[model samples]
Target: NPRDYKSYKLLFGNEKFYDRSSNITLNYEYFYSCIDNMNISIDQLMSSIQKLQFMVVNLNSPDDDPQLIFESLNSTGVALTDADKIRNFLLMNENLPEQNKYFQNYWQPLEENTHFEVSKFFRYFLTIKNAQFPKISNVYDEFKTTYNNLDFDKQNLFEDINDFSNTYKMILECNTGTKKIDVILNRFLELNVTVIRPFIMAIINDFVSNKIVEEEAIKIVELVEKYIARRIITKTPSNALNKVIATLYRDFRQFQDKHNNQYKDSEVIIFLLLKKQGSGRVPTDEELIRNFKHNDWYNINSSYRSYIFERLENHNHIESLSIYEGLKNKDYSIEHIMPQKLSSDWKNELGNNYQRIHENYVNSLGNLTITGYNSKYSNRSFQDKQNMEKGFKESHFVNLNKLPARSDKWGEAEIIERTNQLITSALEIWDFPESTIHEMIEEKEMYIYDGNETFSNYKIHGFTFINDEYIPVKTWKGLFVELFKLLAKIDLNPLIECTKIDTKIGFESAIFSEKTDDTE
Candidate 1:
């Protein structure tokens, strides 16, 4: 066997066996050394391999679920992906000719267009249809269920999936061939907001289908950007955003119905997002400005911080400079005008409360600027930083201009003044959407829940709690349970205390006792 070197080479002569990038040669060498060290010759190795038994499975009937059988196999082979299973589920049931047709026409091309991200494609694809995110592990199950529910033939359904996947590919690549749309898409990607993809995909689909024009599509993307940007600036929790965004298309449809289908699609989206209450509300300009003044702009996430400054610096410029590229090439960095670690000259300029001033204003907006030469300005005094080459005085950035002229000294006062100026610029860059609801409102009456309400033949349309928009409810008990659920989420102890029998609070029986079997 050792003498037959040519045959041996032919047997294991695949290029991957020796290719460095493949890492196959390293593993193969180790395996060969182990075989030699164990006194196992080529004959013994071949004999051992021949003795190994593989359990083969075959369905007794053609109707048996190949997907189930494939899943049930316990072979120590490479595990199948959700996309693989879904593909098998769809095609395994068909005849060989049909399978080949579907694979060639739909499945293969879908995978290729998504760059082989069919699993994620299915998850986001179903999220738009189902109005909720399906767990990655449950994607195949979710797909099967939805596929069964819809009155779609295999060809039509595959076409739909392929169509949506094309748009999704555009979003993932950030190359929609439209500069305005692509810019916004890049911003979303930089923000690392994968949650908004389904919503964006739905919007793009509408545009291509002629349901909305290119202008309206761009407007919707901008609206989404404002909603997300304001929330980020205000430090809102993003946990509930998935549900809100996933349901936007559905909500827009409902809004259209209520308005006798007269409102534009963009208007309905704005209405729904603006009407949200609590943590999900589209932050007002006042809130954004207040937060902008106090936010630790330097320590914010790098992407968000860059996005903020880039928007400000290039705002309304005839030719915008690439702040992202400059930062990448080390041509620019976030410069602290007052310097992070103060020099003695800077200390003297800041005065008696220097430590307090440095601690408070060091990372805030006014104290920060982008400079091409950050190392040269390290801990320099106010006048040196202002008057040096490529300094505040020499910089062309709108943010840095007029900063030297603001005052001769850098201190708490100057930072506050600069922050006020930047806040004015920010207001222009990320302005809140103005509401035109009065012109669009119908003559329908709405109700708000109050404690003293009595059920005297009053039919429930919907109710609003605190700042929450109109939430539709069917029965009085549904409203009561929902209110208590919201209260319990805030603090269960308050509700638990109320559940106990207490004459002082005018409770005769336990209202919400867990032990009680009464449905009421």
Candidate 2:
């Protein structure tokens, strides 16, 4: 028996002599045996038999093209799926792990270099898709580092990645046979810590993909609103959460405005929450109103807060009225007469250092007071507003400054003079109580410096040969006369007003005129 086994093995050792004809014969015999002995139907037997034959053929024919093998297998009436074929082919290779690594490394660069085109690498990855898993820990580490390093302006990067992760998680939930709602909710809670509204929207969008029908999306949004409300009630309130909600409400409102649509259900809930709480709900609104009503006028009915919200809403600067109630107190309601949002011309005149002044002085209620005509005074300069108010005979009740205007164009000397006037007026308003107004005035005076001679070059230079008794040199009269000559050269009228000159230089000053030649 041992001799017979050795003789049989030696006879079959000539693998080069084995051909496709012999392989097919072997496969046919195996299929017949499966059909007869396994009690399976001929189709089932044939289906089960082909995959084994494919593996054998692939193994024996070392130089056989993979594409040809795939095509042949596909053409055959076989039950083995594409995934199964790939798995089997990978299992047959001794260096499968090394080959996979080589393919992944090679393909990554090619795909990235080609701008992520659907190339051979992409196809290969798809073929061996199950073998690849994301390095979530590494990804999260990088995300945390990047998030921590981001400046305020660059915060959107973390937001985008968070959104993508949320989307991926939603997909995983659908396919994975597990209920990990807690994990997902925790992730959402962490995301809420970051004020990134767009990322939240992206997550919502992804979650509501093809799985959610149109009507169901509406239901889902309602559920999300409820969830947000519940979380606000249970969780510790965060400013970041409030900002995210505010931003989302704003974006939704913009969408509604542009499309001429009504506010969505979720947006309405968010708006309600914003109005009720500065950021998120703490105690219920009823409890808050009841507790604060007796003493807190600001908390009870925030008139000033409502006014700001109304103004912002009217201007379309903010889409929704979320902070309407939060800003409602006497202390908070003062509107800045010199609004922080300055015009381009004003900003240019005020050096970049003006930001500090704006934050400290302009944004404060002391510098802000309710105006009867907020829209009309919106972008008007302080001087312009003063003129308008005076002409209208309106009481400038909230006096942030007594000066006629705040001007960036003014030099340090001019600023000091204005500051002195403002302080005097402020003292008068405060009933001239023993105040530090004088000290503040003195401090502003310290900023003043003597004018440099460099400014002299900017002045017009002129000389006038008048009657020999009076030789004028660069005086106002001589300058005007020279200016008239320049205008005359340009064919412009050289009309001079004796009254204007008298008003400017005094009536006692000599008045001179050159008679015009009508023909010339």
Candidate 3:
């Protein structure tokens, strides 16, 4: 009893009082005081703990069903986890010897290797088979229904689960024992893109089963990365991605079957993703490029911003630095070249329309760069930032800092130039997948944008925004109205702000107003 007290004291020591990860605090002093009164206090505590009553049900008859009883009894309590029910149902009917064999061969290894994430494993595994994610609360019932529907023995089901669990483990660990695959896996993990895992696991399963080579599998993962990265940049809603990624592999397989498996897996994936329409369509190169300049990327997910900068700096380089490590170590940060808070010097350098310039490009990619001198560079003028030690001129990120270091002025024109440069590099990093199969898609009559084109010379059929579905335009006024409607749907605050600024819309009267008579 004294030895047990000492062991537990070591576990709940003063140094172990608080856990940051779980946000739990232990009252180690009280615990130690109770244990210090060992003989009297612990004896009373142990007696009370031992005397606590628990109802035990005994199933003595041949017709007794332990699984049903277990489910019924646990219906109102702390609630058994899906994993608990699944594990019990798996071994509940077997004799002790058979249970031990199955536990040792399949279930135990799966539990341990997945780091006890069997519930999540079951959900992803079921998603692969069903092409839809099971509700978190319904995982047990969903898996039970799946088990009953299929003609499967315990060994066959166990084998399938055990095999898939190994792949799932690699994904969770982000270490697939192959450096190339692991790198992409790390990106997916960093972005917290959990919805893509079922499809990723399916591809990895193919690679393991010898259905596809390692190279092709790597290509497919990279393709998926491009898909995800583009969608994020184009500001696509994440809720739509789950359905797209869940059904992608099934659709690919069906497409392959139809073509008699003539196409490579990567080619099939490209065609399948390209064929997607509406909210599910893959963002094209043009859309990605446009978003790079237009979107306030600095305010998006920090992990996504890190991924973009890292790829831009390191892609095709002879030497690479880990931007993630630099950022985490506090030795680097995102620097706004055009400082967020402008001083008189910055205002003068930016010219008379400084407020407009700052509002437009302050958080855009061109005005941002990673720097080790974040504190020193704070609110400094552009020339000072360039000339300061360990500033843009001295930064090791040659791809990012080089062009800006050479620039003499920082203003709207400079931001636009730098943005165009960054956009070019971004295109190279997250380039669209190309295939002759793309030519197979029927083209809509999209008129090219030329400054000299007149509405009177040609009939405008429709227009599209960011590669979305075409919206028909019957008149120039109709086109103007529809464009504003789409923009208002996205965000009306910018439109409302436009009415307050005289220079914004170049109109004699307010274009948007609360009163209908306020505008001509």
lDDT tens readout by residue for model 1, 391-479: 77777776555775446887898889888888898888777666666544453434222333344666665676643356776665556
Question: Which parts of model 1 have CA positions greater than 4 angstroms off?
Answer: 1-40, 74-79, 257-261, 387-389, 400-407, 439-520
**Weakest 10 consecutive residues, lDDT, candidate 3?**
511-520
Report every candidate's CA lDDT. Answer: 0.77, 0.38, 0.80
Please give each candidate's TM-score.
0.78, 0.20, 0.77
- Among the numbered candidates, top TM-score falls to 1
**lDDT (10s digit) by residue, model 3, range 175-288:** 767777898898788788888999999999888888888888988999999999888889865655766787898988987887788888899898878776556778888898
Cα RMSD of predicted structure 1? 7.4
- Pairwise lDDT winner, candidates 1 and 3: 3
lDDT of 2 by residue, 395-509 (tens): 3332323332443332233434543443343223212111111111121110111232223323333332221122333444454556465555766543444344435343224
TM-score-sorted candidate list, best first: 1, 3, 2
Question: How far is each candidate from the true structure, as Cα RMSD in Å?
Answer: 7.4, 31.1, 10.9
